[model samples]
Target: MHLRIIALALTAVLTSCAGVQVHRVTDRNQPGIRYWRPAPYLALVETRTENAVACEVRPLMLPDKTEEYAITINAGLGSVKATPTLTDGWNLVSLNAEADSKTSENLTALATLLKTGAEIKARGVTKPPTQPVPTCRGVFRVDYDAAGNFKGFSRISL
Candidate 1:
């Protein structure tokens, strides 16, 4: 009876771990490139610089598997979404900057107000605030096999 209980507990822990297993594969040729396989059909590539971080989500299986989507997060700015294009790949979706510290403070204040049921005022500004041009620190081109398995990634110029 005691052995049965221990067996059940062990099985539960192993099953949970399997569901959250992530494989990190590094390429010897490209030392800078990093790969993470979070799921069977999805792979994530990330590269970081002093002031910025970039990530790309490459689908292993898709009708047009050659495409890749990338996003960059700047220290001063929030997240910038990019879409792949034939001519200029990974075009910025928006031009918005969020001051990290100030944004966090504002969010905390807003959450406090909501908890207290305080009235909030909404203001509209005519002109959109201009932000500095976002720099592309590192861009990569991910390769996959015919069977939809990730081969590796190579650094590409913007």
Candidate 2:
């Protein structure tokens, strides 16, 4: 019985580590007042649990990137809220559409990803913070632990 338990534990660890998927996606529906704002290149992940999210995130384009963006996932409520810090990496250019149907679809997609234990990475360029600022772009490698917890996001060359 002890041996069986150990095997199960080992299997769980391996599964958690191997179950995660990370990649870059363009979210054209950036949320905000401006309609012509540029879209952002987002690196999103789908893990097995919520703990897989990192307290900090560093992307290749914005190495100084932090978890300045707040994304809330309420699986029970089927809702999500993302607020940007307006900082260099978390600037509004990477924003998402909040109240529109397309935004709803996007959030729903985001919810599905998080519900399955996923993470997102987005970067924006546009230093002057101007209205016609360029879109944020970046590439990243997602790192996680065997226990299904997020370790960190490692910046990688595109």
Candidate 3:
């Protein structure tokens, strides 16, 4: 009876961890990138220089298993919608920058870094001043490679 209770507890913990994987990944071959879907969840990627990337990609998985993603960028300044095609269960979606020219250039550089095994820490929080709050607010120090992704994410007070 005690063994059965322990098994059930372990299963509950593992099941919750499987949802929305947020951790440090050094190897470019890690499987986290395969499950990174930027849609239906608000991903707020803020850089060290305070240049921010806030947008969500709504993925429409078609009958043929291809996905079409859509999102609007920069709500206050101007809105720009971007669509990227996903196939073969993996695809790199290019997020077009809607900020000023310089900020846009910065985001391009960051995107390149993300594609090259750079680790970004993700957490869930309530963003301030917005009636409808966001789900995940990822704070990434533009320099940390793969150290801070995994540890102490749960200790972060929401």
Candidate 4:
């Protein structure tokens, strides 16, 4: 009976933590093509045990002067708000759209730095460039651990 209670309690605690949070954050510091407005990027945050364990950002489609942009999250496991089933290893969480033109440019520059063996920073987050920056049509694959912590991202082939 005591073991059952302990298992239930642990399950409840784990359930509360297994999810993903996504939002758009505007980076006014990054240069925009218009020279007056900074571009926006999507911030993907992973939570485990109700605490954010990892974060990554990707550029969104640039908004034209006359159009409004809205960001949405679509996960492979269902809504990002849904609790994910615990597994023994990593799971693919979300598949995001391709990099925008501005992002492509920034990524190209970062790739150059990588070739030189220099560290690179993307939107203030410094990490080594993993794979070649995808073109505007390439899709992004985001993965997470069993505990809902972000693992990393990979580009899907066209």
Best by lDDT: 2
Sequence-dependent TM-score of model 2: 0.19
Instruction: Give per-residue CA lDDT, model 4, range 86-153, as digits (tens).
Output: 12222212223332233233344334423322211121223332443434344455444797455665
Off by over 4 Å in 2: 1-83, 90-97, 102-104, 110-158
lDDT of 1 by residue, 62-106 (tens): 122222222222232233222212212222122222322334433
lDDT of 4 at 61: 26
Q: Global CA lDDT of candidate 4, please?
A: 0.34
Model 2, 1-158: lDDT tens digits are 99999999877544333111212223435332221212222343333455563322222333323233223322222333443334443333333423222334344545553542223332233222212212233444444479744455444456
Alpha-carbon RMSD of each model: 21.7, 20.6, 22.9, 24.0
How would you encode candidate 3's per-residue C-alpha lDDT over 1-158 as one tens digit per residue? 99999999877643332111123344555443332432122224333445765544222211211222222233233333333334444433333333332334335533653443232113212232222324445422111126533222111132
Count the clashes in each prediction. Answer: 0, 15, 1, 0
User: Candidate 1: deviation at residue 136, Å?
Assistant: 10
Candidate 3 lDDT at 19 equals: 16
lDDT of 1: 0.33
Please report the TM-score between candidate 1 and the true structure: 0.17
Candidate 3 versus truth, CA RMSD in Å, comes to 22.9
Alpha-carbon error at 57 in model 2, in Å?
20
Could you tell me which residue pairs clash in candidate 4?
none
